[model samples]
Target chain A: MAGTDTSKEFMFRPTPAIVLCEPQLGENIGTTARAMANFGLWDLRLVNPRDGWPNEKAVAAAAKALPVIERVRVFDTLAEAIDDLNLVYATTARNREMFKPVIGPDEAADRMSAHIGAGQKAGILFGREKWGLNNDEVALSDAIVTLPVEPAFASLNIAQAVLVLAYEWRRAALKDAPLPFAGDEGEPAPRGQIVGLTEQLGEALDRAGFFKTDAKRPTVMNNIRAMFARAGFNAQEVRTLRGVVAALDRRHERPNPARLRKNDDEQ
Target chain B: MAGTDTSKEFMFRPTPAIVLCEPQLGENIGTTARAMANFGLWDLRLVNPRDGWPNEKAVAAAAKALPVIERVRVFDTLAEAIDDLNLVYATTARNREMFKPVIGPDEAADRMSAHIGAGQKAGILFGREKWGLNNDEVALSDAIVTLPVEPAFASLNIAQAVLVLAYEWRRAALKDAPLPFAGDEGEPAPRGQIVGLTEQLGEALDRAGFFKTDAKRPTVMNNIRAMFARAGFNAQEVRTLRGVVAALDRRHERPNPARLRKNDDEQ
Candidate 1:
């Protein structure tokens, strides 16, 4: 309402719709609502709450997020809940083996931001507690949003999963164009330049006959490259390395003590 | 006494002394204990709890972390609580502009790890619920740890503060050494090599006319160095970069471009 052309600007896009498919616990719902409030998400659609609506536990859990719970919309089915939204993302832990792009929370947030920028209403569907969304429910969404988790411990609490995704989405939406560094105001060194620096250092090492064994060559080179890459060596760093390499080469090229002594004695 | 030496090796050595200075609420204490357990902090020192020792609420709130609460040692004064510890860090929300090194939870954790590695006991001091650690109590710490939050809304619950610090300490202590690049033989890159690489990369960029402008030079160069440092480029990456720089230089140095073009046209 603040921005008349809400659909045009990325930030002013319609708030994402959150659909809970038969959420069992009121506390979980309340926490989920609180998590949503943390990131400015308001729209909440409930499809068949187990203990009925307007639960006291949920109200208590909502704490400062009471406004979010007050505006909840109830639906009889998952399809009905997502009918108004143009795009829906299903939150799940399973792989599903679906061809639809399955992305982690960060990537999903990026895609969501792009869609929201286009002025389309998007929704994220969360499953019930005890058991998550069934195959039929998952099939309704455009994409699957999975939290990057260890394979052995994939299951995440309903509210926690929602919280993580919501946080990521808000971050992606609110962030300005990323600068080269965390706090600096400059473009990153061109990718080509960085690649070139890495190559030069490698050649210098090779010229110095550092890679004595063929088997150990790749490993040694990779370690060196990783070290430099991690350091974010700019153009200046490359020059410094060349100097060191040159110094080493010059030292190696100098006549040995035995050869010098033998020549001096002959003279 | 279960495997004293073995447990000692895996035992938590808290650098930030959790000082419950005149805490009134038993439930808060329990919650704080639970939070500490969540982050692998067991050393808790109470400075005059109001509702008597061994409160049921404290135990109930501690839940699975009752062991941490049980092990909490009570003292009459804050100084006595941290006297045995080698270094002490205090957690406070209020800005105390004292010249003493103030750090965030992450840095505090790093420092704690170093102290613990050197076999020195470390502790963090936390204040009461109603009014946190007083000026005098805070001054007793070797360093102050502050959580970066909005100035207008800076307060954090006692348990939450403990949780954050605990999380950072555990992360620093438990972080696994990164796998060695192909030829590194699982050994960490020596500090000297890393420093050399950093210097070399800086020099190379300067030679390639990368940092021509002085105004934005420091920012650009520092950022580039940081990026490479974070990437941890290995030997192979360094070589790759060198080749790229060589090619660029060759292209730039090619003389008689017009003559070459004429020859091409004749051909």
Candidate 2:
């Protein structure tokens, strides 16, 4: 149940507490906790949940997110809840009727990163499941974090809201490590291999009378070279293409009209 | 229940079908529906759901996600569900045993958006909750959608995965809405105002003994101006910061013993 003990890769980084304000149902809270846990966030704070604390419904909903559920900090008021934090961002999908500085999820995540880097506490305030953070709560927040949903139907589920924000936060924090690309792990085929493959292909094409006109020979060679260049053929692909050329060369060398019929039709 | 009639804002856009392959629990199906609703998606096709169709648990969990729930389509296999779609992306966290083009959620969303823009159908495959899409099923997809989660704990819950992918899809689809910034709507501060603010700040800092060395004074002043130049201060923020500087300047003009003692002690 400990914060650092449970968090996986981002255990060292400071994560914002998810404060649920006056949540009506226990199921949504459980679902929200699961969403937070999915993104490596554990701190859960509840401000005046309607059904009160220690609801079994939330526990039932949280499958492997029991750690987040166990350490939930219940608060009597929103002010008392956020007083310990240096910064707070109120989340609302609807365009509010207030003068607060509104920020998107990415920018909000960046600000959270900056704050956490400075060792300052930051939190995201989620309003009641029915009505989002009220005007007064929005006024208390330093800035507003709004999801970039369509204006026609911007109503996001509470758990969905938490997931989006948590996803952005985790992405911003753990962004230094680049994703592993299987293809990029391999080195590009060497110049020698490309040359060998090109020569073999040229020989094969020449045997098939591909470069018939002397005037168009240079243009055709350039086109072949450009095709190889654009293909970015790896060593294995180059070897396979070379084998194909060899197979074609042997067939063209031999008077096998039945096998050469496909090549002739393609040409 | 129809795709166009139900899809909230993106009615005109070609929406992708959410194909769940051998989903075990009905509750997860409900949660997935809720998540899809949050992103304005209504097309859901279940390929061999364990509990069969018209699941009461799914209906109960999906709060006001009636549009997605009502229009749910049941298929006998993955092939039949995705036969109508021109392109399909398989969502998988693990590096599969098969060779397939892996793309992050954002890029997958972009490709989906592009396909939709070209009047082509695209669908995403969600595997079973316990075990993800097998290699044979993954091989059927044109590309794989991998979430950027920590490799240590990359197992995201079925609904969490759905929300993340759906969120990205909606973001890529309806990206015309400009992100809300406090200063983006306002005009940027004119060069004249920036110069005035820079001079004002410089004078205030100088009075407060910011530039201790005569030799470094010009360099420091240039650096300060450059900082302001890079800030891209809007008219309102510039005036506000200038006001703050002016207030500080007034307080520093006549240094009280207490303030001077604090400053001197600090130095």
Candidate 3:
């Protein structure tokens, strides 16, 4: 897909607004914007940046993701930043025992997708660089999203947190199921047809006396069947194997009286 | 393994040492130390810090990685930092036309491990915050480690750079052989033992008249051999399978034709 087209279709889908409340440093803000850009999330709302609006350092630090910072909306308060969002998820490392249900990044992403699809604007609020969101700030959100980090050191950089959440969100939004059997997008043959083909192949082998020497004939045959089943052979693959076996059988139809001698020599 | 014992055994094991050249901020140094810890590398040499040695900010920023900082040795200059090192690699975004090879972090890690195994002390030099190592400093190394970032914005924070290189180094150092098959450390059973076991199993099957169908003879036999081979059966595993086969054969010695038919039906 072309970059612009891919962006437009999923671009600016704007499932969640990233609200940075009183961000301390320009470099961190820039990195956070860059992280947002990774998941195609560009709608950023800044609440009282320390270095002032349109900070040069933030823009410089954004690197390839400067577009995200350029398009960010400046707001005076966290409430103003998330005013248009219907569903808000406040991110924090602290376990405050807020009555709201807590979820991980992936789960939050899944919920975010459903909410956005239902035409609701969702927002994720990030606290300042040093201390995370305050009690009042976290209480304002509909739910809380907490990342699982080492209990001894649960603190994560603001940008790293944004990146983790964005990655999960993008994966959920862009996932597609793998194709079955035939390869690519080909239609999968029915299970009954595949099993029937296996039986046909087995019978042909039986008529050729392939199971003569093996004492645990049933176990050996079952194992063979399991192998074919694991391969998930479609109708065509089974037919191909059968044809090759049939051809071989016809070639070896005339049994030699010296077959037992030849078998010993081969061993 | 006990951490200290494992650490001691591999203490002198050669690794790529990270040398920060006059790093200004303690937080960056702390983060860099944290990155080094991630890759199981504890050797850190700091070239004169602007804020002086053992900054509290660095310790706080390093968080749980204070042990790394505790062991860090401060130096007066780049030469002093790497005087004892046999191979030195300096990181730079600039593509210098010097004769030394320029490699990515992964490649550098691989090379470092190989050299380290040969008992060579390898070091990587990282420049300061404002102005990276001057040309003189860059010229002090054997090779340059550069992260492939966008050409428009290639500058990465010192700690972030350390994180990437450290990650790649640890991955290379700990790379193990594919599993289920024991690696080089474990002794494999002799080939004769495996073959003898297969033959015993095959003889038991032959006595049970498993090779009844002529056409299936080769396929069935070959499949049986392949199944055992894929299981990577050791001498013990082969003996166990043989015992199971013998027991089954003993039970079915009377060979009720109806029972045989039922076994086929079960399959």
Q: Best candidate per TM-score, number?
A: 2
lDDT of 3 by residue, B1-267 (tens): 001112222232346789999999999999888666644678999999999887999988885675478889999988898999988888876655554556766678899888888888898888888767777887898777765432333446787667666656755675652211111212234667667766777777777788887688778778877776765665655667678777777776667778889999999
lDDT agreement with native, every candidate:
0.67, 0.79, 0.70
Interface RMSD of 3: 14.8
Report how far residue B124 has shifted in candidate 1, in Å: 3.1
Q: Considering TM-score, which of the candidate structures 1 and 3 is the better prediction for this target? A: 1
Estimate candidate 1's alpha-carbon lDDT, on a 0 to 1 scale: 0.67
lDDT of 2: 0.79
Instruction: Write the candidate numbers in order of decreasing lDDT.
Output: 2, 3, 1
Evaluate chain B of model 3: give its TM-score.
0.62
By summed lDDT, the worst window of 10 consecutive residues in model 1 chain A runs over: A1-10
Looking at candidate 2 chain A, the ten consecutive residues that score lowest on lDDT are A1-10
Question: TM-score of chain B, per candidate?
Answer: 0.60, 0.73, 0.62
Model 1 share of native interface contacts: 0.00
> Per-residue error at B22 for model 2, in Å?
3.3
Ranking by DockQ: 2, 1, 3
TM-score of chain A of each: 0.61, 0.84, 0.64
TM-scores for the candidates: 0.45, 0.68, 0.41
B28-55 per-residue lDDT for model 1 (tens digits):
7887786565445677788888987878
